[model samples]
Target chain A: MTSHPPAEGLKVHVLPAPFDPANVTLITQGAEALLYRTTFLAPSTPAALKVRPQKPWRHPTLDKRLTRQRILAEARVLVKCRKEGVPVPGVLGLDWEAGWVVMEWVEGWSVKEAVRGWEKREGARQSEQERGGYEIEGLLRRIGEAVGRLHKAGVVHGDLTTSNMMLRPLGSGGAGQAEESGAGSLEGEVVLIDFGLATQATQEEERAVDLYVLERAFGSTHPRSEGRFGVVLEAYGESYKGAKATLKRLEDVRMRGRKKNSKDYPPAVLLLTDLEGTVAPWPDECDSRTMHDREEKRRVPACLQPYQKAESYTGAGSNPYPPHAK
Target chain B: MENITLPHLLEHPLQVCLFRNVENATFLRQQLLDGNTKFEYAFLDASVLLSRKHVLAACFRAINDMLNDRLKSRNVHSEIVFSLSPNNNISESFRRFGITNESINVLAIKVGGDAAQIESHLTANVKGQPAVFSDEVLAEVCDLSRIKKIYRVDVGTKSDGEAARKEAEAFVLGSMALKGS
Candidate 1:
């Protein structure tokens, strides 16, 4: 449906478009929306605007409420990330109905593309004077460590993939070439993006699923999965040194699920509910199968008896990770 | 203060009104109190020699009128206005006026000094913000003679101090004349 001021009267902020209409260019079109690169005249700066459909379907009552909540939640996540020195865009504007946000656009390639090119360059046997290859393994390790920091802060990104990350010049003052090899470790600075699906999680289950999703994403997208993904785990282990027990339990959960013979993958929402601090209420329209599934988990086999005693229980099932919550 | 630009002034909740006398002002106050409207700063302008109740009522009515419109609309609601006045309760007044997170603007015109002081006060407060005053309001104050006389004066509420009212009217009408012609 075409977006027009509704009969109820569309509420607009009355601010002029920051960028000249002619200057704004469409960058990408995905399932949800289209992105545009625009230059906001006030700050004389470049910004990115994500434009979503604005008709009734786009801003349906339920979707609008959810979208508004997501925007607020993402802004809060970004604020937390910024405080912890994560490199994400600075939010400029939030127009909920318009489904648009203006943010300081970072100029860089995705980590996914960076890793691919790194491997490609290394195999080419280029001259030493040639443009140095971006350290692919180091980049993955940095991503893992960043995720580790996030989990420490009690946040599960729900979606964490290389495509959602951006790598820029490592504090080289501006967007300049790499001057020193170790002066700015390529792994030293990486920017995380897209926290739309993120939620607070204090349990190992939710955090583990988040990492699992990323691992699977990497395996599917990147050419070398085994060795490259190992580097990511090593760095993650270093960052989450105190929580090895939790990681071990996550592996156990993965193994158990693997043997279940169920082809259906559980949604992240279900996993988030299993986290200690996360308490997800059943969906309003949950079917009979979900009710049965809930009943099944409620049974709690005695095989988990010794496991339950060793862990400091958080009422139901406690995570065996670091006892202290950040 | 510097001139309030159209853009910046748009950020605040603003309102404008036209009226004849004390009765109108009184009527307005009853509505505001009924509507639970409040003002941080106000400029209620009417002839001092006339009934004080009507002038106050008109100001309150104008404010009440502002809130009836959609709170989220770009146009200012007639309910409240804001300036950088140090009124202690002005912030609270903003809430009473139904202005959620928006800025506030209100004015109470003093009688008998230079009526033009209203313009100066508005000018000072508007510093770098924009305000849109109604043409009808300008006509009621006798500022605009060029626009064909539209509404017959409601005789019941008309006041005697036509000259000072004319001076106040001139500011809005005069600016419009320059812009239109």
Candidate 2:
């Protein structure tokens, strides 16, 4: 007969022995580790503790290195960004030994949820065509504006999906959607979350690729995206130097690549946006076998080396979205 | 098993000089005899005494030297030693013994010998405990113990140096006694 354990104390290490199994709430469990909302007592604080799987399939040494690097890198990036006046969470504490990062827990729905909520509301209000355009477009434009500011501060949102933006309340009891844009401080702002892939960059191409990825995310997730996307570009243009020209060149290269090999260019609307001129042309124009070979060469004049070099400069090699490079 | 408080020991100079360090003993005696705090220069050799009585008599002789030669009445003694402990609870003990100012600097020297048994003892004691003591409590205990200096603590169990092991044991025992008292 097993005796019931006592209700655990306030502050508890998320390890063996004293850990109460009942108190562990699993948020998302991945191959690497499981994330749990754990409570600690002495001056009681609730923290999201991402614990590595006790028995990992990967090699232990490599996994440990990866864990150390990821935790350190995330903390370093956030601290640097915060110092630069970026709206990022303050690091509460860090224990490399435990591989746990304690950060300020944000309270708000993700942009995806917000968009879905608006879609549901519009669905109730009208028919499909009438429902599609205005409201969702407005939401995407706001996301774009947020992305523009991030780029202006030379911080790239490595993973710029709608899921990463939290649509928090406007602030101080007002129902209006006021935010912490480039004005006096507004408490309830639409903040970009998840700095897992974030890194500092000064290159235009790198910034362009970041915008490209977010544009694709907007198009794929929301309806009637083109005009809303233009609004985003408009804001980005206002924020980023020579942004419209760079975007135009990026679009031209994207079109040439599409005609040359349709297979390489997936039918994703935002695919053109993510092409940051990172792919370079052959040093000697060696491969002329492709269909739109001439057109491709004409669009990317300095080849893709300069652009790819720029990408490398911005710490894109370590990005997790396409893990092979790192 | 009770530890002596540092401040209390300082109140009686002759007793402290005899039991503490030979150098400290010599310095205090000279200061007492001189009846002054200002120093030009003074020197005394404590190791030359032929017997225990010779040392006590020498201490008295040194006191006269301080009074006649240096013109100082105040004596402050400073000494350094090394020890390893399972816990740093002496500071709390010092506070409890009423040594209000708790800022004492201690630097630890690592001893490769006598680590295993020390670690085993520490593991047995604090393997699963929390919120043990306040800094004030630790300082109070340290003051009460009269251990003005310490170093080379092996808080883990992997036994190594014979001499250092003994020293660490004495330090730990002294601290424990202070806690109990």
Candidate 3:
């Protein structure tokens, strides 16, 4: 009966005040937030509504505080990123008391969908598929540049994966073709989204960890194209003055990850059944996190790890901004 | 007068009327400052308004905050003017975004009133040519330099056209949304 009713009998389906159910359609129901596609300002302009419903499992005050803090944090980072010219969704509106934030609706397919679609089509092409190499590689470079720009702006996205990146196609057909074809063409700008676990940090370790997380994400999902990730590193190395140093630090982070993934370490207790949206824990929650690096080194399916050495990128000059992880 | 009913807040249907080349700016602002109940409308200087969406967004915030009893100003009308600001300074917001004695293009917004009655009152009081409330008209009236200085954006340097305008609008809306947070 109340807006903040006990979670035992409450359903998040009931949107907060000012949002009519008839107007907003459910986009995706994530663990914390229920994303909705709705029009804002005018009927024609689309926007994303992220609502953090009460968690009945936790204490009411704590749950409310967490919800408020996270919603504000995410909004703040997004605004800061936008002001700094990072390609992220701009915050259209936010209501911390209502546990909701509305953002500009990104119109394009996810990089995950695009890359997977291209891979699927490549298999179909058999031998002649080599021609598509340039396109896919270009997409990788853009991803690298996007992350670099994000880091340059002094925010680290804790969870970095292909799924978190969007390919806003250059042509007029981007949004129209989102659901139809991810395999069609890979020409677009890489816009990062879902900064639920992002932090405002400039430490090299945090930045390395961000890159390391992305590296693992790519390695796990698209093992066949894992080596091509180096192109991402290369482009990132050149994006800004501090990018090269960050790349150098990425090697140390990778070494530590490899050490953790070694065969003798607790027999890999962490089993991620669904690799998609596997969030890299925030620094405070690192102890409770499950890190599954099973067969990380043993599964060497490819031969060329060319350009994989991040040390070569150390020539990046010093920058005057704060920096973030994978 | 254009009767604009936002999708979500249908209960608060707005009666909006835009005016161009206002002949008496000082008289209108005087009524607001004098606290005339008859002139309890959001008298906005249309030069700072980027688009129809910008005006709608401010209205949405004002009305929504009023519904939730979170209004920071005198009333919803004043709150609408405050919402247009990128920061919290109620009176300053009034000075910057609100109608001033020098305002030429003025936009009159009434949250919920009889369309014909409000139109008649505005026509009788305000001395300006009534213009359709549209983006094209707003674009013509918008002073880009003032907007850039207020929002602290490089909207002036980038001449990439429509896309750039939309991007600037996005930042402005974002700033307004995150104003009090």
Candidate 4:
């Protein structure tokens, strides 16, 4: 979850249900949900309460139904993951009508913070430092496997970033495995969180996109560790049955890129005609009666013509189509 | 009887009493069926409850529903039983969680009532020895197999022992919390 300064105006929206603002401390002001650190079930038991406030601009009925669906969707996905033995925070309590969901509090720092901390310490000793230690590789591998397990359970986390994963300290959790823990400490299970955007889908394309988003996120967020990202993919490749196929699809996703860059076509490009091909289209403002009444101006690549000398046609007899379209 | 006030639910403090070797289970169940106002306590069979937190979670939900006027059952006491349920069926919840005629261990809970009145009334009515209300004590009284069957958990094949139990509890809590959604 992207953390920002708590929106002061949001503090005015009293917490839904019995949770009073006085008792629930605001943790972050996300674009969609307001997260709070509060006690649920019992006073000593800590929980994360996510409140989706009402959008006053929408009709009250629609707003309520929308909020309820979102809350239920997140909670249902979380419960399913927990039942499948996925490392995720369990849903402790949920009040969809109140637009709030309380989840078991995951302790320890986020993977983003942990990685950055490691990077900072490693850079300080750069003179004799070796890039990518065993611990770091293990951590990345763990992250990959955690994600693989989630996907294997037939769910895709729409947003897969380091910040969304938590490193719950180990050893205390079970019996064995007293691993080393000091500087660049990554000794914990990678617990994925934030199911707000997750969906139940086993299609390889969606899974590939999920991984693509993570790859891009990891590269941009931790450029220094980008080189070791391959280790994560390698681990993910072996984690499940269709994982290799998903990785293969990841190659195609990378080629297309994340944005719809079709608009960046040189000056003018062919807009499909006489066909079912449909997408963002240029306005066809001229009617049958007005086709000859209006002068049509079109863009030509600057290489061929200057902007001031752009070609203009008063009627359909002149060229009919732009040179660029051909 | 112990006075328990949950966080965010201080307005509805609870008075809970745990009983062991209850011989009057039939009588208590009868009073509830008779709709006796004097027995306005949430009489739960401790066998179905995993731990103190499990029981209190139901209490918190029931009280919150009452506060918001969303109680699905008759009142807060019956609502507590319904809250323990993982579905919207009220009678099924009562049948599974509510005190049974053969219940050996019983948990008597009174919400927002006179503490002295509840304690005296419970002691005079419930024909059993009062036991400490603790997780360890509840663990002894709780039947893991019954809990697994009720929550539909396959904890036996998962991990076994404390880890398995913890996993089961998390799933059970999740199911209970997400009920009716």
DockQ each candidate and list the results: 0.02, 0.02, 0.73, 0.66
Segments of candidate 3 deviating more than 4 angstroms: A1-12, A128-132, A171-184, A258-326, B157-160
Interface RMSD of each: 20.3, 23.7, 1.1, 1.1
lDDT of each prediction vs. the true structure? 0.47, 0.43, 0.84, 0.84
Work out the TM-score per prediction.
Answer: 0.48, 0.44, 0.83, 0.83
lDDT of 1 at A304: 44
Which pairs, if any, clash in model 3?
A: A201-A323, A202-A323, A207-A324, A209-A326, A210-A325, A210-A326, A211-A326
Tens-digit per-residue lDDT, B24-130, candidate 1: 33433444345533322243332111222122222322332243332222223322222111122444333333222222222243221233444464444332233
How would you encode candidate 1's per-residue C-alpha lDDT over A111-154 as one tens digit per residue?
77766666665667667756443366667778878878887777
| TM-score between model 3 and native | 0.83
Docking level of model 2? incorrect
Q: Can you write out model 3's per-residue Cα lDDT over B88-171, one digit (the tens) per residue?
A: 999899999999989999999999978899999999999999999998899888888899999997665325656767778878
Determine the TM-score of chain B of model 3: 0.97
Worst 10 residues of 2 chain A by lDDT: A178-187
